[model samples]
Target: MSLIELHTRSLELAAELIDTVQPEQLVLPTPCADWSLRRLMEHVVGQHRGFAAAARGAGPDRALWRDAPVGADPGGAFRGSAAELTAAFTAAAGTPGRSRLWLPEIRDGGPFPLDLAVGFHLLDTLVHAWDVAAALGPSSAAGIAAAVEAEPPLAGALLAVAEVVPAAPADRGPGRAFAPGRAPATAAGSFGRALALLGRDPDWAPPAR
Candidate 1:
């Protein structure tokens, strides 16, 4: 319910998703058409670090997160990014209500309320968990639920922002229509399926693959 709880839960789900990735599977295609597993992971870690940076008062330029930046060890790089995000968020949680975050590209303008920092990350973590879980098969539902339960605020935010701005991860491709307060006609196959209905799909499966 709180931002800190949401951040922690998102981190936990993300870790679970990361654990599902085999070394060989890292190169495998994911639901997100343009991103392989590795790329999707990179994007996740990058967004975390970027958001943490903003919460720490650093803007996009100084943000530690980068898009597919070369690393000495790609795997280690991913882990490091996750770790960095965890630390940043942990510190932000300590401050509570006092910390600030800004993302001109995502939000309309100006920094978001210091309070909404965790809520923003919460939505990202939950949706991405579904993305990774769908690619890995049915084993990730628990993690998905964790993300969903951790961020009730995110659901409200999603309803508010669904049509206003683009959904997260940027790699999810085109936006789909979603009618607030209405469920889709078909049953959701997975957590990612539910996310797709909401106009967010970080792990959209590529048809060709």
Candidate 2:
């Protein structure tokens, strides 16, 4: 599949997992160590807004990137943000001279190539989808894993980005997008290594309650 297709599938996966979140689950602990599900959802929604603005050359604007908390309807917020992001990316893909867009929130406020920028968003969407599914419990994670399997193109492209994600140990931590780095498991598959590189344990699960 193309980059746009992979990104679209990732967004769909995120939306699907987010739609399953119940009101009570919003307070549940998530894979992101310091964030409740609600906070993580806020960050995800904010990213959609930020990236959309960046795609339009309107960004590097911190306000758009900050966590825009939801009121009573986090799911509704997510849908709107997702649609905005999708539209922005789709438009950018076809427009000339928009190939190198400015993204203020990214490291050093990048003017990254459109394809690379989309990959960055795609990987984030996929990981956050996993985070939400994990919070919903193991069955949800397994179900989403199966859903991803049904779309081989997305899974393959997701791993490709994960395995080659650009980051250094010094660049990861509490205030950053990724957690502290762990030693990569040489024997593991690309997915496992990718998770490790992304600072997530390949076998990580929520604590048993």
Top of the candidates by lDDT: 2
Candidate that would win on TM-score: 2
What lDDT tens digits, residue by residue, belong to model 1 across residues 1-209? 65565456556656755665676666766655556767777777777768767767675463455665523344455456667766776776577663666665464535676556565566666666666676666446445654554555544453333333344454233442222222433644334344654554433444663
Please give the CA lDDT of all the candidate structures. 0.57, 0.79
- For model 1 the local lDDT of residue 179 reads 21
RMSD of each: 5.5, 2.3
lDDT of 2 by residue, 1-62 (tens): 78987898888777877876778778888889868889999999988998898888774668
Q: Candidate 1: misplaced stretches above 4 Å?
A: 68-80, 93-98, 138-197, 200-209
What's the lDDT for residue 82 in model 2?
Answer: 89
Model 1: how far residue 103 lies from native, Å: 1.8
The clash count for each model shown is 5, 1
Q: Candidate 1, TM-score vs. the true structure?
A: 0.67
